[model samples]
Target: MEEVYEFLKNAKTWYLATVDEEGNPQVRPFGAQNIFEGKLYIQTGLKKKVAKQMLSHPRIAITGMYQGKWIRLNADAIYDARIEAQQSMLDANPGLKHMYQAGDGNTAVFYLKNAVAEICSFTEAPEIIRF
Candidate 1:
């Protein structure tokens, strides 16, 4: 989890890579990545494109990259079951509330379960392990 934490904090933003049922890969840039209670959450609305895509295909990849340096994460996503976590994230980031809030009164928040992160230092070619 520490590596995951480092990966999240060090990278400016994660590029979320998702695949449609027909195998079309959809990649989007997301800015809010808050870790709470040992879980990483990406908040957004259910009706949004990514949310709808996740509902159909829960498997996704999130990657953080810079100047050939990167961390590729394999994760399983689920529509968050708890509102407290979502609210907590909103509380932490007051500015993004509008982005997370859908006009119809839906909160967009989801958890990426057990993100197994692979940190790769491209300049070195071989990856190093650190916790």
Candidate 2:
């Protein structure tokens, strides 16, 4: 999980994929990521379609690239509504304060569970980590 978090944090921006109501894939760029209690967390808003889709289907895939290497993380995003979780995410990403406040009714956070992460590079063999 730390490796996954490091890759995402270093990349700064990653694309998350969720399945919509009709089973179509929805992909969007996300910039906030943090690790709390040995888990990787991502933030979103309850009012957003991505959150809704995630609630219905917990499986998600995230991809990002940094320094000619790429990472792919697939996990079951379990919702973590605890205030501490929200605070942890906000604290890790101060810039998010502009869009969301800790404990706000609209703010939602999910931690990646049962995660499989792959680090790949054209010049090196792939490394796979599961947590």
Model 1 ranges with Cα > 4 A deviation: 66-68, 101-104, 123-131
Q: Which candidate gets the maximum TM-score versus the true structure?
A: 2
Please give the distance, in angstroms, between residue 5's alpha carbon in candidate 2 and its true position after superposition.
0.5
lDDT of 2 by residue, 1-131 (tens): 78888889899999999999999999999999998887889999989999999999999999999999999889999999898999999999999999998788888999998999999999999999999
Q: Can you give the lDDT of residue 12 in candidate 1? A: 63
Whole-model Cα lDDT of every candidate shown, in order: 0.72, 0.93
Residues 9-71, candidate 1: write the lDDT tens digits: 567687888887788999988767667776777776666788888878888888887656788
User: TM per model?
Assistant: 0.79, 0.98
For model 2, name the residue pairs that clash. none
